[model samples]
Every structure is written in structure tokens, then in C-alpha cells.
Target: MQLFGGRKQDEALAKREEQVRKLETECRTLQTSLEDTRELVRHLDQDRELLLGALEHLRPGMDVQPQAQVLLDVCFKPLGLACFYVALADWDQDLLRFVLYHEGGRFRNHPSRRLSDRSGLSERVLAGRRPVYIRTLEEGRAAGSLLTAAEQATGLIPHSWYGVPLGRGSRPSGLVSFQSFQTDAFSEGRRRVMDALTGLLSICMDGPPTPQGR
Candidate 1:
């Protein structure tokens, strides 16, 4: 009877040891997976930084066209932007002339084109004084009346858009709008970074000297 009891105790100890070994193996596997996830996140964050947060690289006195090009190159192209437009308000407020426009695979300088009216999207965006990052263009049109028929028909219609006012506060001096042919092209993370970059863009409209470059 004494020998049988000793054997039972030994077997129990061996069973516990085996269980511990299995648990250790699972813990190691989980740790490896966690490390890999962290590394992937780190790379994504770096890409995000370069995509929108690097607007300061445009530098003061950078030509406005060059600045705009750099913005497209870094911000829109990497994220699959199809087109963009930049316009400044005339003192009369009767018109928002296109200062820089790119669409359907080309960029043009349309300093004379009258773009928006008092009730149009550009004016409304400035009046609303907030960035509108629409995940889908259909949703934007359905949500409210913004773009005019001419605005909608005159160019490459967008699938989605993210636009920001180019002035301080609700009374913006102008605006820069980016659009894409792909839905959900812009994300909240990009909007946050672009929001911070507005001041820099405003400065460039005059500081970078677009007029002299022409």
C-alpha cells in the first residue's frame, strides 16, 4: 500500500510539470505575435507622418505652385488622390478664382475662372469654418446642398473629397480642396494633420509668390 501511494504522488507531479510546459509554449507564441503587431503599427505611423505631417517641409518663401505640387506629391498621391484645387477670394467676394487646379491627369492655372457663389460649397465651407472630410461624394450631396451644377459638371467629378478652409477662423480668405476617385480615400488621421497644416498653406499663398512665378 505504501509503494502504491508513492507512485500516485509521482504521477501527479509529472502531470503538473507537463501542463506548465504547455502553458510556457503558449505564452511564448503570444509574445511573438504581439511584437510583430507592434512593429507593423510603428511603420504605419511613420508613413502617416510623412504623408500629411511633413507640410512644414514646403518652407517659407517656397513658390506657391511648388508648394502646391509638394502637397500633392506627398499628401494626395501617396493616398490615391485624383485631383485638387486651390482658390483665393477676391476682395469683392463675388468670386473665388482658381489659383491652382489639377484634375483628370493635368494641372492648370486658371486665375480668371469664377468658381463659387455666395451659396456654393466653397463659401459654405468657409462659413462653416470646419474641414469636411467626406468619405463618399454621394453622401456629401445627399447631406446638404453645396456644390453648384456647374461645379459638379465642369470637371472630373469626385468619388470622395476632403476640403479645408485656407484662412483663419470662420471667414476664410480661400480654400484648398482635395478629391479622389476612390471612396474612403481620406481618413481622420490625415484630416488632423492637415488641420494643423492650414496656417502654413495660408502663408504660402502669398509668401511663396505664385504671381511672380507666372
Candidate 2:
């Protein structure tokens, strides 16, 4: 009986130890899950702050040009790309006349130049009623004779490019184009930024034009 009692006590102790180990594992798993939840909350808070800032910038009565400049400056400067706002006169004309160009660094502004009337890409984009992404300058040059001439005249060598059409319904008002000297510089992230900027520009375009005197 004494031997049996000792054996029973040892068994109880072993079972107690097994229970403690299982409890410890469960506690560690809970701790890890809590940490993951905290990290997710922190990321959500950062995203909320970012979205709020963008909303504030998009408030009504803002100057369109300055707004566009701010968008390009903040969005593309880090990526090292040039941004341009082209205001078109007529959708049927198949032209994108330059309204403004925001250089990445200290580069001087190249004066506004007329688009080549024969540019099919420009016309197709305007008439197609959708945003057009020109991935390469070579594609543009090959599609239209005028593109090559324009490149030579301005010395604007674009290895990669993306453009968005700006207009409501049938009246295509303009286009916004981003360019980079490096090939395939516009990644998926950069493309999303451009989309947001273009959305803001589209809203601004619908409003009344600012007075020349102002």
C-alpha cells in the first residue's frame, strides 16, 4: 500500500505538470494574437490620418493649378518623375496642349508647345473617352510621325509614360501625363497615385475657372 500511494502521488504530479505546459502554450498563443491585433490597429490609425489629410486638401474653393502642383509635388517627387497638366481645347482636335509641367527638381520650365495634329494616340485617347497609358515614347513615335518631331524639338526624352484623360461625358477638356526617363519607372504604386491625383483634377476641372486678375 505504501508503494502504491507513492506511485499515485507521482502520477498526479506528472499530470499536473502536463496541464501546466499546455496552459503555458495557450497563454503564449494568446499573447501573440494580441500583438498582431495591436499592430493592425496601429496601421489602421496611420491610414486614417493619411486619408484625412487628403480629404482636407480636396476641400472646395481651392485653386486648381496650385492643387495640381501640390498633388504632383507630393506624389511624384519621391519617385523622381516629371508631371505635366495638359489642357485640351477640343476633344475632336486630337491634341493635348500643355497647361503646365512640374519638374522634379530645379529643372527650368520648358515653354508650352503645340501638339502635332497628326498624333493618332492623342486623338484616340481624346475620342475613346477613357484614360490612356503610354508605356513608352517609342510607341508614341511609332504610332505618330509628329511625336518624333516633338521629341526632337523639346528634347523631352521619355522612356516610360502614363496619361489620364480629363473631361466629363463628350467634352474632353484635357489630359494629365506623367513621364520618367528610366524605363518602366511607373510601377503599380505610382499608377495608383496618379489615379488619385487625376480624380482630384477631374473634380477641379468641373468647377468655374479662376479669374485672370485673381
Candidate 3:
């Protein structure tokens, strides 16, 4: 009888241990879900602020410089972008000229490169007249050559990047790109927001022949 009692107690203890392990697993899953919910809420707030700022600051009649600055301000922190660039297709010279190349809290001078250059992802977007999104630089490199020697030299290479063609012509007139240092930073929702933002940008970018070296 004592042996049987001992066996039953051991069985009960094992069952309790199993229940405790299951509960711990459930708690971890709940914690992760809560964190994801918080992140989504943060992104929604940022999107709201970005759209409000765009409405107030971005106007179709604005010049390239002012509009570009407004765009950078509204987008940089809200979208958590590490770099943003606006490169127009100069088909006449077969070049892609960057009007705005912003990074590290300021703009940088970007040299014009031939449209045929595989390194400039902007050219690929223009050529395809579509969007290109890479979750990592390794993915981009695997798809094709990722960056030019000059761009690589900057030492600010992004972990994730996305770009969309601008304008409705047979070939896009330009491209607007956003870069992030964190993998999977730009979700489908964020990409959709960027698409809307680019529409406003296209309106602002319209009107003038983008002069060389802007």
C-alpha cells in the first residue's frame, strides 16, 4: 500500500511540473504578442503624424528644395529611415541625377551615375517602372550588384531598402527611396504609406526640369 501511495505522489508531481512548463510557455507567447501590439500602435501613431505633417507642409506648388526638406523632416524619424534619396532619370545624358541625398541628419552631394549602372537600385526601379524592396543588403546583392564603390565607401550601408518609381510615363521620371538599418523595418503597411507619400512627392517634384547638381 505504501509503495502504491509513493507511486501516485510521483505521478502527481510529474503532472504538476508539466502544467507549470505549459503555463510558462503560454506566458512567453503572451509577452511576445503584447510587444507586437505595442509596436503596431507606435507605427500607427507615426503614420498619423506623417500624414498630418504632409498635409500641412507639402504643397504641389512648392519648389524642389523646400519640398525636399519638408519631406525629409516628415519622413526621416517617423519612418525610421537611415537614408533617403530622390534621383531623377536624365534620359538625355543617360544618367540618374540625385536631387536629394539625405543621411545622418543632413544632405550629401551625390554624383551622377549612368542609368545602365547596376549598382544604383534607383535605375532598376525606373527601368522596371515598379518598386524594389530588399529585406537585407545580402538579399539585394544576391539579386544583383547592390551598391557602387562610392556608396559602399560611405560605411552607412542599410540592412533594408525600398524604392518606388515616380511619375506615370512609359518610363518613370524618377524614384524615391527609403533605407533602414534594421531588418524587416518596413512592413507592408509602411510601404503602402510610402506609396501615398510618393504620390504627394510626385506632385511636388512635377513642373520643372530638375537642373543638374541639385
Candidate 4:
């Protein structure tokens, strides 16, 4: 009877050990999931800040058009660009139409009604819905005639250009462009920042949906 009791005691201890190990594993998994949730919340918060900044143009008595233009212009400063353009995809014309443009700290509304689907840094982005950073105009492939009438009228073409598609999924509805007379003006960091800014811009203007969590 003493020997039977010892065997039963050992079995119970072994079962308790197995249960403890399983609990530890579950705890570790829960800890990882909690960390991931925290990180996602942080990113969403940052994105909200950006969206609010862009929407500040809608305040009462504010000049909405010029403010929108300048907001995009200043955002390009971090990219070290001298000029920026905002274009929307025109389904009727099957092209990207020039809407707002900023240069030399001046905003031009409806600079041109011309559709841009031929070639240039802009068309490439409109076609692919992806950001394209050009180090210099010399290395451009089939983009020699990409300048808009308004841009040409200014008598200055940026030597380098960076353009981002402004919409979600495979096809975007608009384009945001940054350009500079200096060659290789865009860096990897600048491109990444523009990606975030463009997303926020879309959220503000187009009401792009983000993950729900305040």
C-alpha cells in the first residue's frame, strides 16, 4: 500500500508539471499578441496626427484651396524639393489631370487642365500607383516631354523628381509630386515619409478608412 501511494504521488506531480509548462507557453503567446496590438495602436495614432494636420485647411474663414496647396508644398520641404504638384486621375479623359501646383512658395490653382498620361515621372506613378523617385532628369527613360504647360511657363524644370500615388489598393485616384532643380534630391527616408504623408492626405480629403481604434 505504501508503494502504491508513492506511485500515485509521482503521477500527480508529473501531471502538475505538464500543466504548468502549458500555462507558461500560453502566457508567452498572450504577451506577444499584446505587444503587437500596442505597436499597431502607436502607428495609427501617428497617422491620425498627420491626417489632422492636413485637414487644418478646412477651418472657418480659411482659404481652403491655397491652404491645401501650401500644406502639400511644405510637406515636400522634408524631401528637399523646390516644387510640388497635385493631380487627380480623370476617368473621363483616361488621364491624370493637373489640379493644384506649388512653387517658390506660391500656390497656383488649376494651373492647367491638361491630362497627363503620355510620359514622365507623373504618368509612371499614375500607371503603377507606386512612388517613383528619379535621381536626375538625365537618367529619365521616355520622360523628356513630361513637363506641363504651367511648369514650362515657369521656365524651370526640377532636375530630380519624386512622385507618389494617392489612393489605396492597385489603382490610386490622385498623384502627389515633389521636384527639385538639384540632382538626386530624393533620399530613401524622404520617399518613405512621403508615402506616409500621402496616405494621410488621402484620409483627410477622400475619407480613406483606417483600422478602427481610438
Candidate 5:
């Protein structure tokens, strides 16, 4: 009778320990989630302040390349963007030209891609005429090619990619893209900021005619 009683006691102790462990795990998860929420809130605040100053700097007469650089600068630190590019669509030629490409903390040349190329990421954005947010490069590759042959040879493969089309209607005039080495780099808040910036960029690009011409 003593032995049986002791066995029951052990079983109860084991169950209690298991419960403790589960509670500990739950606490850790909650802590992590809270920390993430705090960080996101902080970023949202910083982004808002930066954007206000950026708007003052981005004028219609400014060159496209300079404007691209300025936009990247505004979000580079806040969003962790490692790569950025602006590709203008050539509907007549069915091509997308990389007019402004920035990567590795510097500017670099990028090759153009055919709009009809189903394997390229730009084509997906153009076809949809909307923002394309890729959480990881693997996901992008599964749907279509993420990089060109030349890019594959020398470029850094980004873990996250986001592209927003410029203009509206059935066809967009261009694409502005940002990439990062970390997976899931863009949160919902970050995406909203990017979308806003891209929208502002579109207005500057297609806004009223200037003396210098577009």
C-alpha cells in the first residue's frame, strides 16, 4: 500500500512539473511578442518623422536617380533595405530598363529584363500592377526566377524582396523595388511606409510638367 501511494505521488509531481514547463514556455512566447510589438511601434514613429523631412527634399524638378537615392536613404536604416532599384517599363519594346540601381551601400549597374519573361520577378509585379511583397527569395524562386543570369553571377541574393509598381490602370509606367538580406524584413507597418513613399515617388515622376522636362 505504501509503494502504490508513493507511485501516485510521483505521477502527480511529474504532471505538476509539466504544467510548470508549459507555463514558462507561454511566458517566453508572450514576452517575445510584446518585444516585437514595441519594436514595430518604434519603427513606425521613426518612419513618420523621416518621411516628413523626405517629402520636403523630394521635388519634381529633381533628377530621377537622385530621387531614388533620397528615397532609399530615407528608409534604408529604418527598413533595413540592402538593395534598391527603379526600373522603367518600355511598353513599346516590351522591356524594363533598370534606370537606377543601388546595392551593397553603393550604386551599381543592372541589366534590363523583358516584360514578357515569365521567369522574372519584375514581370509578376507588372502583370499584377500592384505591390508584390516576397517574404523570402525561396518563395520568389518557386513562383518564378528572382534574379537574372548576370545578377546570379555577381549579385547578392536577397532574402526578402518588395516591389511597387508606378502609375496606374492596365499598365504601370515603372517599378520601384527594395530588397533585404533578412527574411520577413518587411512588417505590415513597414509595407505601409514603403507604399506611401512609392506613391509619392509616382506623383513626383508623373506630376505636372517642369521647365527641365521629365
Candidate 6:
């Protein structure tokens, strides 16, 4: 009888040891998962801070447009943007028209051609009030039917493009566009960053700039 009791006790101890091992394995897995989640959160937080900081440097003021252009040059030029344009809303045409254009490295100019009331690219963007990032000119050709006639007329071929609408509420007031000579230059992350930059631009355009002559 004593031998039988001892055997039962040994069996129970073995079962408890196995259970403890299983629980420990599960605990380790849970810990690893928790650590991974924390790391992801940290990375996301860092990215958010970086974006906010960049936006802060471009915020609206008397000097906003020039500062914004500088910010855009620093941020987008390295990413392959050859030209950048900002179009203000034209109520008569119900479209955005280029108000400021930055060409070369530091020259601020205006667009020679009008983009308002166009059908394909600018029209689609103004209608949707969303950002359009094209990796290839072929994609733009397919997506921007409004620009076909103009492109053909001017003998211009856009190889790559990115555009973001600027506005408040449902009525978009303007657009910011980036053009590249290379295909597939803009990525989803770049689009998001451009969206953030445009948001700051909208705020800058809300009030007229103070005059210099006083």
C-alpha cells in the first residue's frame, strides 16, 4: 500500500512540473510579443515627433511662404523633386491656380501656364481634394486626361509627379505639386509627409501676408 501511494505522488509531481514548463514557455512568448509591440510604438512616436517638428518650422506667418518654400526644398528636393508649385483657389473658375512656383534651387517664380479648369490631373485633384502621387508619367497620362491637350500642345512630358490639395472643410483652396524627372520617385511615406506639409500651408494662407511698405 505504501509503495502504491509513493507511485501516485511521483506521478502528480511529474504532471505539475510539465504544467510549470508549459506556463513558462507561454510567459516567455507573451513577454516577447509585448516587447515587440512596445518597440513599434516607440518607432511610431519618433516618426510623429519628426513630422511635427518639420511642420512647426513651416507654420504660417508674414514670412510663411518663403519659409515654406525653403522647407519644401530641403524636404522634397533631396527626394527628387525638380519643381514645386503652389496654386491658390480661384473661385470664379472653381479651381486652384498656381500662385507661387519655386524653380531651380532658390528662384521663386510663377507658373507660366494656367492649370485651373483643367480636366485630368489638376481637375481630378481639385474635385477629389486628395493627394495624388504618380510614380510614372504613363500613370499620369492615364489618370490626367485634362492635361493631354496641354501636354501635346506644349510638347511637355511629365515623368513623375506628386500633388496634395490644401483646404479647410470641404472647399479646397489650393494645391501643392512636386514633379520629378525620374519614375517611381514618390512613395506612400513621401505622400504622407507631403500631406502634412500641405496642411501647414493651408494654415499659412488663411490670412494675407503683412505688407512691407507699411
TM-score for each model:
0.64, 0.56, 0.76, 0.59, 0.75, 0.58
State the lDDT of candidate 4 residue by residue for 92-204, as single tens digits: 66665666777766766543333443445676776776887777767654454366556678867678887888776766777888788898876575566667666656655
Cα deviation in Å at residue 14, candidate 2?
38
What's the count of clashing pairs in each model shown?
0, 0, 0, 0, 0, 1
TM-score of model 6 vs. true structure:
0.58
Report the number of the highest-lDDT candidate: 5
| Candidate 2 C-alpha lDDT tens digits along 11-96 | 99999999999999999999999999997677556445434455566544565566666555555545567545444544355345
| lDDT of residue 58 for candidate 6 | 59
For residues 97-156, could you state the per-residue lDDT of candidate 1 as single tens digits?
Answer: 766788766876554434344545566666677777777767767645355344567844
Ranking by TM-score: 3, 5, 1, 4, 6, 2
Off by over 4 Å in 2: 1-54, 90-97, 103-123, 145-156, 208-214
Clashes of 2: 0
User: What does candidate 5 score on TM?
Assistant: 0.75
> Which pairs clash in the backbone of model 2?
none
Candidates 1 and 6, the one with greater lDDT: 1
For model 3 the local lDDT of residue 172 reads 80
Ten contiguous residues minimizing lDDT sum, candidate 4: 58-67
Between candidates 2 and 3, the TM-score winner: 3
Better of 1 and 2 by lDDT: 1
Model 4 gets an lDDT of 0.67
lDDT of 3 by residue, 1-69 (tens): 999999999999999999999999999999999999999898898888888888788877676667777
Worst 10 residues of 5 by lDDT: 143-152
Task: Give the per-residue lDDT digits (tens) of candidate 6, residues 95-163.
Answer: 455566655544454443344546556656776778777778778778853343444666665577877
Of candidate 3, the 10-residue stretch with the lowest lDDT total is 143-152
Best by TM-score: 3
The window of 10 residues in a row where model 2 has the poorest summed lDDT is 105-114
Which scores higher on lDDT, 2 or 4? 4
